[model samples]
Target: MDNLRRRHITSFQNGVLEPIVFDDKRKSMKSILLSSIKLQKTIAPVLSTIRNFYNKYYNTIHPLCFTFLSFLTRFYLISLSDVVMWDESHFGKFASHYLNREFYFDVHPPLGKMIVALAGWLAGYDGSFDFESATRYPEDLNYTFMRIFMASFGVLMVPLAYFTSIELGFSKHSTILVTLMVLFDTAYLCISRFILLDAMLLFFTLLTLFCMTKFHNQSYHPFSANWWKWLIMTGISIGCVSSVKWIGLFTTALVGLYTIEDLWNKLGDLSIPKIDYLKHWMARIICLIVLPILIYIGCFAIHFAILTHTGPGDEQMSSLFQAGLIGNDFAENPLEVAYGSRITLRNTGFGGGLLHSHVEEYPGGSGQQQVTCYHHEDFNNDWIVLKPREMEIYDNETDVEFVNDGDTIRLLHLATESNLHSHKIPAPLTRAHWEVSCYGNDTFGDEKDSWVIEVVDDVYKRTNHIRSLTTIMRLRHKVLGCYLRAANVGLPDWGFRQVEVTCDKRNNPKDTYTHWNIERHWNSKLPPGGKANYKSKFLREFWNLNVAMYYANNALVSDPDDNDILASKPRQWPILEVGLRLCSWTSDSIKFYLLGNPAVWWSGTASLMLFILTLFWYLVRRQRQYTDFSPGFLMDQFTASCSLKTKNMIFGIHYALIITIFWYFKDIAYGVSSPNIELKDKKWLSTWDIVD
Candidate 1:
């Protein structure tokens, strides 16, 4: 038994103690074995070191898992119902139209809407209906699906921003901060919820900027395959952005400017023999100018093809030529076309359109009076305060009973009475014993003495032949005045006078009357029945008065005295609508030209010029001095000054510019405006008010 116990102990020490042997051992023997053994020792420090190393490197979850968790968290935390807004409706409608094979004059580019439609189709939602009908799924589900799409983009932007920041040499923290800020911004959040183009624009523009920075930093030749590829990508990206909105021109402009500056800086660095200046110049031209121009043209070609494909009709080609002509015309003459009819006078040597008519014919006519004719208070004479007057009477015609006193009366008569006292007119035109009389009868009263109302002018005026004609001419010059005065005669009214003035034509500037002239003959008659005979005279006289006034006012105002005084007519709504449509069409054309061939043309030419200039300078100057021509002087300074802080600042600027571009152009591309509410609002505590 002791030998057996010894054998068991030996077996345990050797790690060969089988379960059966242990089970078969007696209780006393087991206790003795348990107490007799020292506790098994461990390499605690080595284990601790190993554990520390693992925690440092492998304890954190895998990036893929983290990303998945992030997406899940976003899905759970964000409320899809909170995404309700105008842009979403517009996007849904546009996508539906696209999916239904319906043609539409979409102002925005089709990429973002296409993506949304694709998502909807994959999710078993109909993309060929209006938002309310197409989004028939539960509101939360529909919105969540849309939000998830946008959120995916948002998350993508995080990595893009990081890589771009690194390419720009931004510090790690600044890059992270910019990404975080964008991630949490309420505007960004809300915008992302809808399938809008802004976020996409931001992404593209950032990518472009990054690529451009990389291109600039490279020391390789411009004609290298890699360089060409980068340039092509840059061009395509910029073109896409511009396709979304006209404002993308700003980005294009910036890129062009930077390229030119870079070329200029490199021009002074060329090493060439003075005798072989021409060869070097040719090389520089090909590198800087020709290559860039080719790239720019290639970019523009894509845009041109797209635009031409989408434009309405074959008129686009002719319109383009006309556009060029119009631009030249505008540069030559800056005047805008007159708005309305152009009157041309016949049988006059001065005949022209009314816009160019002589000012003497219709002086001082206000533009406002041409469109709407009405009686306005004569502010020139405060004593002539006259209210609008109307006379009404009942007339029964066959079966129709007409009530003159009712609100439905159609005929209206306007009257004004002028008080003529010896004190009102000049004393030379007034006499002591002259009398004025008026006569009129009511048609409804059988023309009896009781139906007639007689009026006598209490004031009188004595007039010589000259003065009487002068008064007649003045009175006839006012059309409405003459009409009212003619109606007032032979009626029960007061204030009538015949006045005259005496003056020689050469000496009297105010005496416009000529009694013997045929034009003034109609002005000599008395009122009421005489109105018909004076109609032409009244029109002529009033027109002359208006012409005189218009000139005088024009002189005082320092404005043109052309006959187009009344040319400022209200724009017709249809015409305005047509004009807007035309403008949009033309704008699209301009954008296509700018994005496609123009970019290539300009960039290539600029590069060629830069290269040529560099070669020329290199050949002309000997032993380049730092102050005079060294390109490396400024380059070294620039590189040295680009510390971490400066790089961060630059990255910040890049981020800001990219974001701003997105904000401005997104609406144009998406056909929607920003919303007016927060993305998430939690109101847990509130005061309640009850009204009875």
Candidate 2:
């Protein structure tokens, strides 16, 4: 057991053992003592030398020595499996996208993937491999190098935890307890050995925590160079963690709340000068808010700069942004909105999309072809602009009529041959709004099918004449007096998850979602729009992209139709109620079980519970005015905080007993070319459902 301690101590050269010289009365004692004498002579010098070396160098090299051991634990047999595990498949593909100079979209922010791409580049990977789940890597892919580089981030995490404990005023043995918990956490070790973003995410998380505590310590010397440095570093770490994943926001929020409380305390200090207080507020605002924002934006800028090529993610962006991509030709759209011209209407909202319709009718409300806002363009997106009439066809002859502002026009779906119509029936998703749908053929339509155009183009000029790709306008339902809008209200399954389009009754002048722009107009009679007309500022595009990403992320829900073994509720994570199977379960494949060392995880949970109970106990006593903590009662307060360094040995004894538990489960992390039946003892924890 790793917890086993040495029971025997070496004797000093001048002490212990009677001399070898024996009399006849003690001849038998001579034989017994001779063997012991030879044993001491053989090993005593070596044990003394080791003890001297440890005593002399332990303090100086312990961190380095143990950190190296941590690395070994993570790196050992890391290459045993050449297959991508768990989220590595997803992240690895994103890395290849970067290496190939192609754009892609993900729910997370970009810095972690960008670093993974950098890792691939440094590893000499040429972006040729597709990382399919459970797929073995190719010989020349150099995944090992990338993994090693990524794991380097994880390696720093152990030391970060160690130093963070010291900064938090943990005693020597308490610090060892903290560091050892991190060191032996199977989840941390195994996760670090992969080409996944968690390694960086967790490293930055720990770094942020460490910097927060370190900065708190420097609060004693406000505005000092060290204080400012740590404060700024804390902000940078927050930015990095956030860039890795949205989960980082939890840590950022923790620091933010603490800072708020700190500032509030300082504000109430009557003796503090107003100027110094102002400086404190200004410093925190600049470092905590502005600095992190700059870092986050800088990372996105790098993301946009590197991904200039047209990609599958183009559909998620505005037509203007798509046009700016290297291989997209979306700018070659007609400039004028002539009658009979087929066009796509783009809602001007932050994350709005093209007006779309499908043949599926609403299950509720006015049963008609579903009208929705769709990010992707398709034939269903094409709507023919026509004069407000019941005409079956329009002639694109010499006598042409261009749709203008204040002109009432009927929109006919090119693919479905139905007129865009709105009625008083409440929209399925937005109950307060009118249902927008495609109803009736071109030959048969009512006044409800007609919409009045109100163009409000650019700042330089008022455009009464509608211009494609540049004019901003609103489509008002002629009879109902509601504006066509798309506010990212998702439709039901019958509507295929597209955003609901409704005729909003509210006449909010600044409701961008209610505004419409004619994009990708097609009329053989009109001139094509110039690419210059479609240019957009990076900030505008970035803002809209994030909005779209937020909406998309919000819409993500687990499928109720399928049983997902890998997915677990938040409650299950703390106690290891489920273990994520990282690869296919087979006799031949190398498998990784994503479970933590139960001893560490459970102890952490217990500590949190203990803290809550301790707080409750103190609060109850305070309420009753049991405040005479002169000497005897005062010691309990110190003990409650666990700040008494005098009892470290007791703490260490308990820590080692916990470590023995961790030692039993080490194989689940270190090597499992194939998990044998015996290791099902991994099911040692009642919560681990590893067999399936």
Candidate 3:
């Protein structure tokens, strides 16, 4: 190539008289200038052809080819590592529950699991896999069906991202870049191939952003059916996104902001009538908030309907609530309440448990029998309600006496045959009051063991009975002048890790910690039809389930225990400082690791940071340029400067970052501040990269 260039230069010199050009410097400069112009004219066509070719390939063919390759890679060997990885155990079991029409509880909403179940059902999964942790999947289980279902979402993400970039006004090269980033992300791939909810969440979130981008690009054509389609699709996608995980709310928020900005732009348009603002408001309200909520509720309703038979999740709900489900023991016939009834008491307090006693004595102080509140049901949970004074059986009359509010009673533990007694001893945990324990002789009680029943004010006017499903009451220790409080804190090992029971001096009637309700009652007078009305039962059960879920989610503690060295933090995510162990072979020869690819993740982080800086820069420049602006006028100026497409993309990036951070905190225990640790050794980590 060099020799050819030299030959061409010599021929050009021979043709143009090189000696004259060298001899006269002033003429040589002018001659050189003219030759340069002639050379540019000759090369312009070639450069333009090269530019056109680059644009054609990068803009037209690149994303298409990349998306095909992404799908191929995601679908290939996706089921090679045939084992339950990380959370697959939990989600797989949830899928099994849905297939069997059996109810189960989980921290997340049911849409993702329902999808998994639907895929499995379609692919011939018999709901036989136990989905236990570290267990090898049976050969007959429909693992590939569920995995392919999840991977499909991942495969779809590439094209969705590509179109979203185009909608955002990105060049062909930029769109290709976006497609490649999502296509090759290792963490995303790993999550997609597994039976987990995160893949579904990502899919719906991307779909939501893509639909919103479409809507934004078509905002000028509001009267068009395409705009309405995109708007409704955006709302439905939001519902699906949020149904998979609450982290999806971030995407919903971005859509909302886009709608607001779109309306604001309309308000700024002097050509449009002011009354048109009302139309925009009505359109957005119907499409964004109202439609999404309906779809969201519809998802839950479908979930409840499909999981008709009772299963493991029943224990989390109330006994009365469970009595309404088709397959629960309480659904058919419930007994009436009567005095001296053998019953089970349940507290409605947060993390509150049933009053229970066992043969084990207290750990150290006072060494009396251990009495505590347990969340789970056990034989020891049963108790007998007896009046303060022992009554002889009136052999002549067979009518049973009913217990009531303000009735003084003595609760005798059914298992240990000890009275539910309170004394002056300090509580093991809540030290401000007296300790509660079962401390009386068998089938006998002392005055100190007496408790005065005070039904919660709402039910106080009515007579108290064991069959009163809505009853709430408190037990006041007659001798201690205090209320029996089921302190939410757990006791040490001696108490079997049950919640501590204490006697509090403050007799607050409304204190949930001291409230107890009768759950199971035994009497012969009740009819057979009972309270098993499926529709109302489902509603009440759903409400209670939501309440419990809300409480449990908010009450989650983020402080890791001493043994939780593998816990991750939100801040560590951006730096790729940690990885989750997905699965490992029992022989230690193979493993799967869940971590993001450095090339994809770090570049994305950098790009997002650049986006943030660009946004700030744009805002500052806009503010400085537009000085004489009203509040609405300034917003109008801002919207005009940043087109809706660009604004949606920016907001989408922001939402992605926010959701990632939100999920990190929600899933991982991230309350503690810890020093950032770099991955100093990059040795054999790829051995666990199942995709490789």
TM-scores for every candidate against the unseen true structure: 0.35, 0.84, 0.76
lDDT of 2 by residue, 464-522 (tens): 67877667889888899999999977887898899999999998768889888877888
lDDT of 3 by residue, 1-692 (tens): 32222211233454683422123455668999999999999999999998899776765676678678767867867666676777889988998899899878876777888998888888788898999877888988878888888888888888888889888876443565567667766677777887888878998999999999898888788758998999889989998998888789999998878777778888889988767778778888888899988877777889888877788886676656566667765534344456656778877776567788899887755678887888787899998877765545334346777777787888888888888888888888888888888877655667888898887833223544534445678889887789988857888776777888889999787787888877666545444336633123446556666667777777665666644534777887887776765654233323555677665666667766766665677678788894443322122334456766886675466446534533443211111112112121332344322222
Point out where model 1 deviates above 4 Å: 1-79, 82-84, 132-146, 220-222, 272-692
lDDT by residue for model 1 over 188-210, one digit each (tens)? Answer: 44444455566566666676676
Q: What C-alpha lDDT, on a 0 to 100 scale, does residue 490 get in candidate 3?
A: 84
- What ranking emerges by TM-score with the best candidate at the front? 2, 3, 1
Q: In candidate 2, which residue ranges exceed 4 Å CA deviation?
A: 1-59, 336-340, 348-353, 357-376, 390-405, 415-418, 424-444, 455-467, 470-472, 486-501, 508-515, 559-562, 617-649
**Local error of candidate 1 at residue 272 (angstroms):** 8.7
Question: lDDT for model 3, on a 0 to 1 scale?
Answer: 0.72
The TM-score of predicted model 1 comes to 0.35
User: Which structure among the candidates has the greatest TM-score?
Assistant: 2
lDDT of 3 at 392: 55
| Clash count of each predicted structure | 25, 0, 0
Looking at model 2, residue 19 earns an lDDT score of: 32
C-alpha RMSD of candidate 1: 24.2
